[model samples]
Target: MRDPAPRAVTSICRALAEQIERGLLTAGSQLPAERKLSEVFDTTRITLREALGQLESQGLIYREERRGWFVSPARVAYNPLVRTHFHAMVAEQGRVPATEVLSARLMPASADICELLQLPGLSSVYQIRRARRIDGRLVLYVEHYLNPAYFPGILAFDLTRSLTELYASEYDIRYGRVRFDMVPTALHNEAATALKVAVGGPALRIVRVNRDQHGRLIDCDMEFWRHDALHVSVEVPD
Candidate 1:
C-alpha cells in the first residue's frame, strides 16, 4: 500500500527527515528559502516555518537571522548502558552507517583525559575524531580517546569500520561495563560547523567511558548530537 500524506508540521518534519536519510539532501546543503519552500510544498509560509521549527528542534536544520536554513550533519547514538557499537545500533535500526575519519593521531593525554582513563601524565593516547552518518545524513561528531599502550597500532586500523569491533577481534578487548553522563548544552562554533547548526543551537553533550572485561578503562568518548535529529526513549518493564 502507498504511504499516507504527512498531516501537519510534524509530518512535514518527518518528510524532510526522510530526505536527509535518503541523501536527497546532504550535510551543509542549504535548504530552499522559506518562501520558495512554501511554494514548493504548496503550503502557507506559516506552516512551512512550523515544519522548519520542528526540524530546528530536532537539529536537522539551523536558521540565521537573514541567511536562511541549511541541512545539519548526522550523528551516532552511543548508549553506554548497551554493549553495542554505533554501527550495530544503526544496523539494527535498518539504516546505513558510515564514518568519515576527520583525524587520528597519537598525542600526550590531557590531564583530564588521563584522569578519566586512569593513565599517567605523558602517556600517549590515540585521539580519533569522526563524523558519523546514518543513511547518508550527518548525525554526530565523535571524539574518542584510547590509551595507546592498550590499543597499540590503533591508528593503523580502518576507522571507516567500527573501532569497538576492531578492538575485539585484534586485541581481545571487549567492554564489560560502561558509564555515561548526558547534558543539554548549546552548540559552540566548531560543534556548530560540524553539525551544520548555528552557534547556540540545542545539542546533547554525551560523555562516555568504557571498560574492558577486566574492568580496565578502554576508552573515553565525547559525542555531540544535534538536538533535532535524535530522540531518546526509555522502556521500563512492569
Candidate 2:
C-alpha cells in the first residue's frame, strides 16, 4: 500500500539526478523555473520541491538567497592545525582560489581586541576585511585585526596578498602557537551579503589567533564560511 504520487516523485528525482551525474547540469548551474520543471514532470509544485529538498540534503544541490537552486561544487578540505595560508591551501586542493580586499583601515582596538592581543586601552590596530572565493563562489569572509605596533606602516603595503609571506619576508615572524575557536552559527549583515547567503543561514565561524616565536600575539582573524562549501579536517598532535 504505497502512495502512487510518491512513486512518481522518486522517478522525477531519479531523472533529474541522472542529468546532474551525467554532466547535463553542471556544477553551479541554476535549475529551470519551478513552473517549467513542474510541467515537465507533470507533478505538483509541492511534489517537485520535496524531490529537490532531498537533493539538497544529499549535497547534490544548494540554494542562494533570492536565487534559485544550483548544483553544489566540490567542498574544500581545510586542516586547521596546519600552518598553511588561505590562498595556498585552496590551491593545493586543486581548486582556483581568489581573494578580494574589501576594506582596510587603522582603527583603535576595542576592549576585547586589546585583551586578546595583550595591549593597552585604545591601542591602534589595522583592521583588514577580505573575501575568499573558490571556483567563482564566495565561501568565506574574514576580518583581520593586527597589532600595528609590530609592523609600522603596514598599511602602505598590499593587503590583498598573503600576510604570512609578508610577515616572514619583512618581519621574520613565523607562527609559534596558533589557537582556534570554531562554532556553528547563523550568518548576518555584511557577512551574509558577501557570501550571498540569507541572514539566518547556517555557517561556520572560526576565530584564530596567531603568535610569533616570542609568544607575542601578532594578529587574530575572524572567518565566516558557508557550511556547505567547506570541510575541516585536522590531526591533533600529542
Candidate 3:
C-alpha cells in the first residue's frame, strides 16, 4: 500500500484473520510474497507489513526459517495425561499424524536427568529424540530419557513408534502415577531449529515424568511445542 490510511491497515488485518478462521486461507498455506500482496491489496509495503505483524501476534500466522509467512494451524486441545497415543488423537481430529525418530543413544546420565528420575547413583540412560507432525506440519519435538536398567537391549527395538506400547508389550509396564510441569518459553537451539521457528519464537515446554505399576520411574519426557500448535486442557476428577 503506497498511501494507505490507518483504517485500511486495521481492515486488512481483520480481513486476513477472518479468512484464516473460515479456512479460506487454510492452515500452512504460504502467503504471497510481499511485493505481490502489496500490489494485490493496493497498499504500500509498509502498510502490508504492519498488518502482517498484527496477524503474527494474534497467532493467525507465523514465519518460517528461509520461508515466507503461513497461516497457523488450529490449536489441538491436548489432554496432558491421556493414555491415547499421539497418532490416535490426531486422527480423531481429522489430521494426519507422523513421527520422525531423530536419534537414539545411550549416554551417561547427567545430574539433572538423575535428579528428575530419582536415580541414586550414576548410570546410563537411553535417550530418544523425536519430532511429531500433524497434517505434515512439524509441531512438537520431544526428548525421552529412560532408565536403561528397565530396558535392557532397548536399542535393538524399532523406536519410531509409541514408547508406551513398547513398554506394555515388552515389560508389561503400565503407567501409574505421572507428574507434569509446564511453562511458556522462547524456543532456542535445537528445539527452535527442528520446529522451523526462530531462536526466540514463543513456545511451550512440557515436562512429564511417568512411573510404572511398581512405582519406579519409566521415563522423563521433555516436550517442546510450537506456541500456537496446541491448546492444552486437563480434566480432573476430584
Candidate 4:
C-alpha cells in the first residue's frame, strides 16, 4: 500500500527542478511564497516543504534563517593541492571573495591545539575567527590558530586581508608541507550563527595544518563550509 501524496510531491519537485534548470528561477533568486506555490501546485504546504527539502539536500536550493528558499549558485571548484590562497583562487574564478575577522586575540592553546602545533603545555597562540562570503553569500566560517612565536604584532594589520601574503611579507614565512583533512558534518552553533543557517544544517569541514618553509609548524585552520558552496577537485600526475 502506497500513499498518493508522494506522487504529488515528486511532481512538484520535478517541475520546480526543471524550471531552475531552465533558468526560470535564477541563481540566488528566492522561490515564490509557500502559500502562492501551494495554490499554484494545488498541494498542501507539507508536501511542498518535502519537495523543497529534497531540492535542498540535492544542493539545488538553500534556505536562510527567516528567509525563504533561494536557488543555489554553482559550486566553486577547490583544489586543495593548489598553493593559491582564498582570495586569489576566488578571483581567478571570477567570483568575489570577502572575509570578516570576527575575533582575534591571544588565547591559551587547548590540548588539541597544543598537540597539533607541537607547542608545550600552557603556551599561548593567536586565535582568529572569521566568516567568509562568496558573491555576497555566506559560505565559510573558520578559526585560525597561529603559533605566536612566529608572528608578533600581527594583530595590528588588516585581518581581513590574505594571511598567506601577510605571513610572507611580515614574517618572511612561506607555507610548506601542508596537510588537509575533510569530512561531512553538521554545523555547530557558532558556525551556524555566523553563517545564518540552522545549527544542525549539513556542512563540509576541512582541517588544515600548515608548516613554514623552514619546516616548522606555523598554524592550523578549521573551516566549516556550506555543503552546497564547493566542489573539491584534484588533478594528479602519473
lDDT agreement of model 4 with the native: 0.94
lDDT of every model, 2 decimals: 0.79, 0.86, 0.87, 0.94
What's the true lDDT of residue 66 in model 2?
78
Better-scoring candidate (TM-score), 3 or 4: 4
Q: Which segments of model 1 are wrong by more than 4 Å?
A: 1-31, 35-55, 58-80, 236-238
TM-score of each: 0.73, 0.84, 0.89, 0.96
Candidate with the greatest lDDT versus the true structure: 4
Choose the strongest candidate by TM-score.
4
Residue by residue across 43-90, what tens digits does model 2's lDDT show? 888888889878875677777777888888878888987778988998
Question: Mind giving the per-residue lDDT tens digits that candidate 4 earns over 80-178?
Answer: 988998889888999999999999999999999999999999999999999999999999999999999999999999999999999999889999999
How far is each candidate from the true structure, as Cα RMSD in Å? 7.3, 3.2, 2.3, 1.9
Model 3 lDDT, full chain set: 0.87
Better model by lDDT, 1 or 2?
2
Enumerate clash totals for all models, in the order shown: 11, 0, 4, 0
Off by over 4 Å in 3: 1-9, 42-50
Clashing pairs in 4: none
